[model samples]
Target: MSGIRDAAAILAERLHAFRSLGDNCEFGFVQRYGGVEPSGLLRFSYTPLEDLIRGLRCGFSDFGVPGDLRLSVSAGGTYYCHSVAYNIWANTGHSAGSIAPEALLEREYGRLAHLKGKFLEDLADGTKILVRKTGRDDPESDFARLAEAVWAHGPSTLLRVTEAGPGWVPEPARRVADRLIAGTVRRFAPAEQAWEVDLEPWMHLVDGAYALARGAAPARLDADAFPEVLPLPGRLRRHVGRHREPALSAYTRAVDPAAVRGDAVHVFSSWVWIPEDFAGTRIFAAAGYARLGWRDADLSRRGCWQRVWAAGRLRPEAAREPVGLGMIGTRRDAFWSVGARFAEGPIPGEGPAPALRMPPARFPGRDLLGRLVPRFA
Candidate 1:
């Protein structure tokens, strides 16, 4: 169990690190035959999971494994809840005949107990956290039997109900199940928080990160993009205007527009750190951008901000030029401005997870990155 604690801590640390980078990082893992492979800092703008799936299939094919492989994968980043580490065991080999879906559902029934005994029961007191369990269970499966079981444990955030198998019911029936579970769970769990979902893994709920992964750089706004402009504080004005630099300039540096590729750009107010090397004509856009107070919120909230800002699209040619971009910071108090480079185009919805393009060379692919990275989607 201490190993579980250590692994959970590692997962927590990885999640915390990924979140701390603002919105400029990606993380993912691929599991084959119970062995987890760390998909190295995925470079997709939004489809790490999709790419990971392709990579997994490709890797399996390369290994010449037979039969239908069981796949249990989770992929998403930044814009997601911080999930503790969990494993999805999958096998590759000859089929062992069909198994009853109900019997398969039974396998999930003990998951919560397994989690509680090994980890939750010993967690430090007053550690605010949330736990969710998802599988293919329906009303006929008697999922309500475990209501008391879940209620016995803690995590007071919300309740999620997922019915994925053949016995899935309509919205009304699902709601009834949700109501029954919410009504029975004797805790601060709210009725509104009881959510019913599709057959996909619960980790799929964090698709926002994957969806926004690819897209046109928001900083590339057209001339007519600015329809609204608000007043700015004097301190903020000098910062974006480059009239003064932040005291902690030592820790931050200016970004080069020419160097921007598929990376995401974030704006910050000059009061905290001066944005250098911006196009001269767009200096006013900096002050205008400062209306968003994301930097301030980041200071207080620590890890809450994760959504991509829908600023404006730049022309393909504009990718080489710097542009002043602004967004309503996560805090919503004031906007922030920065001269950034957004080379990636916008992706609608899940779009396509980028293709897995391992260089054409013979090497130990699995050994290099084969460590299970906790999916905190």
Candidate 2:
């Protein structure tokens, strides 16, 4: 709220599609109206926290999906938003799962770390790459080399199978990696083989650890895997949705909303249904932005909030009675101020501003993967 103009300017650039008000408009811009016929809305302020509360309360009770919304203001007029919601699209895989040895190897996304060249640079920071070589996976490949290394090392020397790229790694470098792997417990993406190595007492990789070797394996480890998820981009530890993770996968924690001097904003495109069980429970989640609905009123609660529009030829002013329907206009000069002061003159009919539309995700940064740039609307 302190640097109102600056904030609007920054947000406006991110939201280039929105029709801008006059250069001197005090408040924010207009909102999206999902309807035919000449219908529109002009938003005085972006109520992020209020919207989140409404999203969760209504979402849990009706939709069974509890969303997170935070809107609070400070004396300095600083406002921020933290929105969380189940990624409807991403929840299916983990809803029910089975983890076998083949599953573990399939998700050995840790192998992505061993990559180099332009391929590595092109990938997102956290993308998991598979170990199986698509280029040329031969019998005398990295896997065979690893088996020999393990047998040669015996019990004294440690055996780790990290390889930079395809093919067999040099023995000297391989030995060095083994030394580092000996004492550490971190799950290194060992060079993979074409076939599975089934031992009589199958050694399970549970939660990135060799379960059978480390004392007695936890009873839960026998299952091989469980519902797991990773925090989305920009979110500290909020899961987009429950997803199947390897038995040796890392755990994802919840990120609490921290006080901020600046504002992180987003908008919900529909009246989200939330259950009652989610009361006072906060979580983080993020994913993709997809349109659920169109109407702004449907997105908010029932009668608690109302969409207000200006009633004038030009951009309408506050304090002035909601007289005419607000659609399009020239600049601020065509409207009146709350203090009963006329801006300039009966400004000429300029035109309608560009229409503002819904973003892809309902709750970004908090409930799903954070969006860096504004796309459609």
Candidate 3:
């Protein structure tokens, strides 16, 4: 079986979640076999399992994916716990998925034999350093690497384009997801949410040239095989070409075509990079594009801090400082929140995952940006 299907079969059965009063099957904790204890309850959906699988395999950020995602611990055969996406983020909402430390180590049902985990939480917790950031760099931050990966792969979670819809109609779902997530920032983000990029991919480059670096191949994405740029309507292409530089014009060719249409309204929404390395400091962050961080004009400007955030949590241990935009999220946050080895967002009860967004793209600067922003961008 594919790595994802193997994980789904295991955790989907063990998770504990809460089901709202909707017209669907009930979902929560489930009892196990062979006298095994019950896996704790969680709130998640098993539908669109494909999206969840892509999220686990590629480390697709919640924002980049069209639908939202929930990671729940799934284990099979007594050893190894896999963090799998339990729900697809769509118009309805997402599930509350988390596991306790004690439950993950159970002898018969939860012992992780020789399995090496690779979920977002694992990377955040620093297990899969190579996969998380790949020690790569871009002008702004490693997140650029991740963004490139997400856009290139076009995982089902974030690729919602329909065959016949207007070039960009499929984009509304993403904007809606962002609005739902913004309200839950402080509650979920790490008390110490921060990362340093003084000299990355380069530092690694220098290190690679030194010891232990000989024979080691550099980590990178294939520049030539990026997914085909989504087709843009003729008018939209001209509109983008008129305002953006050649580089941006080339870049927008790859962005969700609908988001860039001149007539379409959009908000560059929620972004989190969980697997980033902060070295030794804690920071709290929320994705934003208001007056505080990068203005919409900078969207075309690469390598600059775009998704900035107001820093620090209410907790004193969590340092207070401005959070520059980059891929943000990690196991450290989950370590404090759920005591689990890894997790995507904060544990369900700790805080809601707010659908954050970059400020709406400002063309001429209109008052109705608040309403029109989510639709295009």
Candidate 4:
């Protein structure tokens, strides 16, 4: 019986490793095992898509939750690309709120038009519908097109639009753009919010839209007033000094491997709470980082692992791999790292820290909101 228990432990470690490798490659960074800091809430503008993807991946990988992974990427000159892990788990369940490609596009376009009209009306007078197109051509047209694509296409298109020169948008238009870029709004009701529509889905849509229109995403909206917040940070910090053993133990008890299908398991941490139905019997794990202004009680910390594993286990093939382990949270303000112990080897001693890479370059003329910097010429 002791030998059997040992074997189970070995199997869990191996499975976690396998899943971790796959996740790291896809997003260019590991999910869990990082730290965070308090850099003003407005810092979301300075964050790059690559950094956000890496941070989110690390967070989910650590917690060991389960589900599909989705991200919005930028493409063409004025388009943003949206991607998702395509599989049964992501598609078949009641899991979260999802907008069809057409619906997402229409909703975003309507919002843009509404906001634009408001800004214009507040500034000058006559502002009417001009034209709206969706595609990747006619770079100089007065009315540019924006196309929304999905990552299921293996680099699918998301938002494709043409660039309109200054002549098309006069001085009044400039002020309107400034106001639209700075504006923000929120919804609170029912005393309780659903994770699908109220949180994750809204985050993805709003962030993607901001990326396309403003060149930056919105920082997380505060929900402190809500009850039962996920991933209490204080609980997470306590688990850390003990090398995550206590947290792992609690999670193991919460999960039942017998209920989980497939020979392998994966884990991740995230900022959103995952429903128990998604875990089944899989051995899930969680980790926390301190960067990105995530406190010990931040839901993103707990939600990280849930998000990554959920994405990986969407297919039986992915679930059959060497098993997986991940962590999420904020990286220390300056550096990033990942640590693991294989089933057959001794854990290595601590070493020099890894350097965080510089964020991607912003286009010279583009503002944080993705608008072109005004050029008199």
Candidate 5:
């Protein structure tokens, strides 16, 4: 446990030296394990943190992880992750295409277009100040006054009530909304009254819109917020793609050895910069794996005209040995490589990585919202 903590501290220091801590870059450092399943095929696991570190250090005596292993560190530039989550939630499903009055006001005032960067900066710094209103009177007028106050404050974002009328938002819906607002907005005070806004146990339709153009809305807008679209700090879309696409393929088994429970795979970690839509420095660190089996052993069967589908297919007879291609180590070293060498002989000592993939990176962005609504689609 101390070793892992020390490792984390070292990683933090390195990132700090690299200036990767701020500048809106998401950072992650994790270790992945590969297990030589009972079938002699390799399977990689996502177990993250202490358990993963423990397994790796112990030669995985508990489960028998063998073959090859590597430690991973990564960082990526991103839009404010809270905004990204709100945007994704707003643009998908029922919330899609639904415009907010606050959004209209923002364009009219040009707050987001001109002040987005500053707003994000404040939000990230936890220096954002929200002036709440009782909303006992007209919500429209209250929203207008709130907007003016925010404008006077200069370069801050807005949080408004999504629904109008007398009834409070339903408890579950209110919980979601409060979670989004309180999570996004860091601090707040009363606009017209002396009382402080209820944030910790927040249950209001009002919420912040730091990334309004990126689909800003309070949680009450849609209670069924996609689990994938929750606030996560410095979480760029590219990292998510790596997890869903390539990393996922490693575990799902693009090709599987028949009758074997779990085996026939090779894994490694890679470091590369993920491209950003806007011009800015970015970082990407990841561990990826590939299956080591004949194309004929592909788990998914191709129907008639398989040859047409799989053009340039290698004959199973010609491709006699199973070879899974993978690369491991830091950007500098190919500490390990699989493909030709793995087919020839067994690599010693590293054992297998582990039985689980690293868990998703945790940061302050999701906080309460992640707990309130655990199910994400």
Candidate 6:
């Protein structure tokens, strides 16, 4: 048998032994087959005996294969577990009807076993150290390398041996697995900075490493020795301000008229003033050209007028120049019929005499008109 096939056979044997002990295990395989022309791929995601319908549809979406793919999933114990298998064929012209999922699994299982064995052997020789040397300048990259080493060589090794069988596997496998797991947990866990970046992968490796280590040397495993690394406190603090509401009372109290006159308060708007009550106050009304933080405009040039409800009149105030209160909703609909009043007479060098082109009739309303007309009552 080829090296890949031989390794797969070993893995299968180990898996069989694992199942014999009542430990639940699921197996999956993905295969691709085709020719020079446009080909088709079929996938079967099955577990032990049950085939999952939903999983098959999802497999189709995930692979993006033209031909139909099949998937199945099952549980070995009370809790349902997942095992997936996939196959792809290009121009073979053979329908997937003939291939059995189990046969494909058996074939691929051998290849996986061989690959894993080779990986373990390279791991044993400290290949990780060589990889780390290639990018020593980047701290994040260096830490990832260290973390991968711990996972591949340390605890994961022990867990594999223990799961396989205590006495069934060679003494060397058990010893190696144990030493790697224990050493990694003891050394790496306490290093706070190392635990910070890409923690998911590190944790995965750590768990597998720990399991393998304990399996190899059950007596040597110190349950309490594992160090606990907590997340950084500063990271949480940064996000608190984003979700908090601003203090309205404090903001309203801070608005100063003198500051506005001095060009300090460039932006204007009721929203920027904080307290909604100050929306139409004299300070806001007189400073028509004042900048309101929310809206975009030069407040110094264009003044604002209001439609007074008490007098039922549209009162137009030209603060410095005869400013046109542009049509309310649309520029074409001009509401210029209301008489326009200026705060001061025309200054020298002023361009044109300010004009108020009012609408045909006075604004509609008794109470609103009352505010504009001088009160006789």
Best TM-score among the predictions, by candidate number: 1
Tens-digit lDDT track of model 2 for 291-361? 11112112222212122111112112222211111112112111110101111111111122223222223
lDDT tens string, model 1, 156-262? Answer: 22233333344332221112332231111112112222211111122122221112221212121221122122122322111222224222111123233344322
What is the C-alpha local distance difference test score of each model? 0.23, 0.21, 0.22, 0.23, 0.22, 0.22
**Where does model 3 exceed 4 Å of error?**
1-109, 112-377
- Sorting all predicted structures by TM-score, with the top scorer first, yields 1, 4, 3, 5, 6, 2
Candidate 6: segments with Cα more than 4 A from true spot: 1-73, 76-99, 123-377
lDDT digits (tens) for residues 190-283 of candidate 3: 1122111111111222222211212333222121111111222312110112222122111111122222222211112122222122221222
lDDT of 2 at 245: 28
Deviating ranges (above 4 Å) for candidate 2: 1-137, 140-142, 154-204, 219-284, 287-377
Instruction: Between candidates 1 and 3, name the one with more favorable lDDT.
Output: 1
Query: After aligning candidate 1 to the native by TM-score, how far in Å is the CA of 316 from where it should be?
Result: 21
Candidate 5 lDDT score at position 52: 26
TM-score result, candidate 2: 0.16
Better of 3 and 5 by lDDT: 5
Off by over 4 Å in 1: 1-137, 140-147, 158-258, 261-377
Model 4 clash tally?
Answer: 81
Count of backbone clashes, every candidate in sequence = 19, 33, 39, 81, 22, 62
Of the candidates numbered 3 and 6, which has the greater TM-score value? 3
- Cα RMSD of all models vs. native, in order, equals 23.5, 29.9, 23.8, 24.4, 28.1, 29.4
Q: Give per-model TM-scores.
A: 0.20, 0.16, 0.18, 0.19, 0.17, 0.16
lDDT per residue (tens digit) for residues 50-139 in model 5: 332233243233331221221222222111111221110010111312445344333323422233344334434433323232223444
